[model samples]
Target: MSFNVALSGLNAAQKDLDVTSNNIANVNTTGFKESRAEFVDVYAASLLSSSKTKVGDGVLTAEVAQQFSQGSIKFTNNSLDLAITGNGFFATVPELNSLETSYTRAGQFKLNQDNFIVNSQGGHLLGFPVNADGTSASVSLSTAEPIRIPTASGAPQKSSEVDIRMNLPAGDSFISSAPGNFDPEDPLTFNHSTSVTIFDSLGDSHIMTYYFIKDDPSVNPNEWMLFASVDGKPIDLEDPAGGGTNPVGGNISGPLSTGGGLTGARLVFDSSGDFQSQIPTAANGGIITSDFSNHLPNGADTSQTIQIDFNLDPLGPNPNEPTQFASNFEVTSLQQDGLAVGRLTGIDIGTDGLVRATYSNGTSEPLSRIAMVNFANEQGLKQVGNTAWKESITSGEALAGEGGSGTFGTINSSALEQSNVNLTSELIDLISAQRNFQANSRALEVDNQLNQTILQIR
Candidate 1:
């Protein structure tokens, strides 16, 4: 009986040492929780035995429990790295579309070949789909899906409208040459010129330069001539060779006619340098249309018609719009409604677990919202490998929610949670367990010595 008791004591001490050693080994592990070994003393007595004199039997290993406390967050440079401040776990899946799920506190994640966010174990990070306004479409865990980032944005759209606000100089001199004899290459032909890049249907850029030439006041008072060209090609008002409409095809055969120096729109301003023309609501504010069709780089839409809007807002009143002031000729603002396909620039994770992806085209959209889960009994969770926990019979059902909501913790981007194991405490436990083993061994040796003495007496 003494031998059995000492053997049990030694086994209990060894178990304590093993638990302590494991804690020390994983001291630097991410999201690792420390464990403790518990024991209870056994007694040799039956139900009908004497109640006053009961002898102790041995020590028995009762249970090994885990400690689930908050770990310290270590900030990193990677934006995908995340850390939870309080209680909650990030739900992950083993494969891209796999429904078999796993929970993790380690937030070290990166993009895979298919632009899916995954962990070191290739587990896909699951998230709820979000609306365009950055709100979660559904918060249910069953509705969660793997987060994927698109390589590029939508298709390219051709430039159809241009909004420009400019201040034309009232004190500028008129062109020395007549409108019919004006040349785009010569400086004295046009008073001022401003150019902007516009996109075609195939995402090709075309330089659209607007030349503002001050006209002769003797011919037309408070008026200016606006000459426009695309890629240095003169937009003809009427065919110079023939008095018919200029057809848009292959290439121009001869010089374009400018209606005998009355080719472009006449900017008729009031005497006070204020605009008096009512800017209409049609395309290009009902002013002029530079309609043309030319072959694109990749056989895209060639029939491109761009309306140049002079008024800032087509619907609003033309109060202090583009004016012919006494100041220098300057383009205050110019904007177009065309965009080329954009590449993925970066991603951002908010405290609310919202993942927003930004593109190179100066546009951003919400991709998904990370789902956070919490169990009623964290210690009751079964220890799976790689610093992860699994749902066990002892652990209650997982309650899913977004980060920073209720009992769930908030997500800290660019950060990671370190192991909660205390090295110093583990070392102390190691020493205590070693002493217990030595004491048990000494008791066993004493028992053997007493047995030898009894045999010598017999």
Candidate 2:
């Protein structure tokens, strides 16, 4: 009995040493959790034995339980590296379409050949589908899929509208040439000129120049004539107030004949330099509409029409309209509603695990939301290799949710979670286990000497 007790003590002390050594060895490992060895005294007695005289047996190894505490975060330069500040695990699968899942805290992730995010072991990281506004469609683990980034260029959009605000010089001289003669090549034909780049349906850019010709003040006071040309070809502006019909408080002659004719839109201002009205009004809120189909580049959309908005708002108290001020000509604002084909620039991941992709066209699109999972019993998880775990009977079912929601933690991009093991505590435990082993060895030696003495007495 004494020999059996001494042997049990030796085994318990060895188990303690093994557990402490493992904690110390993995102190620097990423996402590693430390474990502790537990023991209980082994004692057995029959009902006839007196309780007061009973002596306890040696210690027995119970279990080596893992401690799933929070690990420190270490930042890195890679944007794909992730770390959880609180509770949650990143769910992954061995294959792209595999449903068999494993949970891990190790966030060393990179893009594979197919642009799918994967870890060092080639496990595909799972993410939930997201809407266009960056909201998750579903948070269930079953609906999660492997995230893939598209390498294609962003879609192109044709120019539909243009908002321009400018101050025309009130003291500028009229055109030296004929009243309706506006030439893009000759500076004397127009008072001032400004050019803007506009996009076609095929993502091609073209220069659209606006020529401002101060009309003969003797004929039309406080009035200016605006002519537009695309690629140096004249484009005709549609008469919004119907053909041959002039607007109120405006001096506009009958519509000019089409087919290579030099026509212009009339801009009328009040005495105080405030924009009162414009010719070709009554349509599109007094803005001029021009169809560039006749002068568009080959293979471009011929039906695309651009509306030039002078920011005229009669309802608002302080409308952002173009002004004919005494100051020099200055354009306060100019913007076009068009986009060219965009190439992939970079990627960003937010705290809520939302992944967004940026493009060269100044546009960003939401790709996916990372899937996070938590178990009811983290300690009961069966440890797999590579600091990963599998669900077992002791561990409850995995509860899936988005990061920074519910009991889950926020995700930190470009960071990693270091091991939670404490080296100083592990070293102290190593010394204690060594002493326990030595004491058990001394007990065994004493037991052997007692046996030798008994044999000598015989």
Candidate 3:
């Protein structure tokens, strides 16, 4: 019995030493959690034995429990590296479509050949689907998919409307009074000119130039002629009310010209330099709509129409309306609703686990939301290799949630979670286990000597 007790003590001491050595060895490992070796005293006695005289047996190894605690953060330059500041684990899979999910805290992630985000062990990181507005569509783990970045260009959009706000010079001289005198090649034909780039249906760029010609003050007082040319070709504006000949030019022979010159829209202003109305009343609020179906580029949408809005509101006093102020010609704002095809530039991950992709066309789009999970009992998670764990019976079902919500922590991009093992404490434990092993060895030697002495006396 004494030999058995001494042997059990030796085994317990060796187990303690092994646990301490493992903790010390993984002190610098990323996302490593230290473990402790627990023990329980073994004793067996019959009912006939006296309780006061009963002797206890040796210690038995109960279990090796892992300590789930927060690790220190180590920042890096890679944007894909992630760290959780509180409770939560990043869910991953062995392959792109594999459903065998494993949870991990190690976030040394990089892009694979297919642009999917993966850890060092090639485990694909899972994420939830996101809406157009960067909101997560679902938080369930079953709906999570591997995060993949697109390498192609972003979607292109054609120009539909343009908003212009400017102050027309009130003191400018009338450059032309004769009809059909406006020519894009000659500067003297128009008073002022401005150009903006608009997109076609196929994401092709076309220059839309606006030429402002001050009409003869005596003939059309406080009025100006607005001529537009797309890609150097004249475009005609449809009258808001009905069909009517352009006041500046005689009639529209083809798309936007009469007698080889571009016809112009009449801009009428009040005495106080406030815009009153247009001659043709093309659209409500003096907005003009031009159809470029006759002059669009090859393989482009021929029915595309662009609305040129000068005033935001027609009935109310709008400060964004065009003015004939006595100041110099200055365009306060000029914007168009169009987007060109863009190449992928970079990616950004927010603290709330939202991933967004930026393009060279000055556009940003939400890609996905990283999936996070937490178990009811973190210590009960079965250890898989590579600092990952699998859900077991002891550990309750994985509860999926978005980062930075409820008890889950915010994800830190370009950072990693270091090991939580304390080196100093582990060293002290090593010394204690060594002493225990030595004492148990001495007791075993004593037990062997006593048995040998009893055999010799026999």
Best by lDDT: 3
Global lDDT scores for all candidate models: 0.78, 0.84, 0.85
Assess candidate 1 and give its lDDT. Answer: 0.78
Cα lDDT, model 2, residue 372: 96
| TM accuracy, model 3 | 0.92
RMSD to truth, every model: 5.3, 2.7, 2.7
Q: Clashing residue pairs in candidate 3, if any?
A: 240-282
In order of TM-score, best first, we have 2, 3, 1
For residue 298, model 2's alpha carbon misses the true position, in angstroms, by 3.9
| Candidate 2: regions farther than 4 A off | 176-179, 241-259, 286-288, 316-319
Candidate 1, superposed: residue stretches over 4 Å from native: 1-5, 40-60, 151-154, 176-178, 215-223, 235-263, 266-273, 278-288, 295-298, 312-320, 447-457
Instruction: List TM-score per model, in order.
Output: 0.82, 0.92, 0.92
lDDT of 3 by residue, 309-411 (tens): 7874557457988899899999888899899999999999999999999998899999999999999999899998899999999999999999999999999
lDDT of 1 by residue, 9-52 (tens): 99999999999999999998887888999899998788899868
- With a 3 Å backbone cut-off (N, CA, C), the pairs that clash in candidate 2 are none
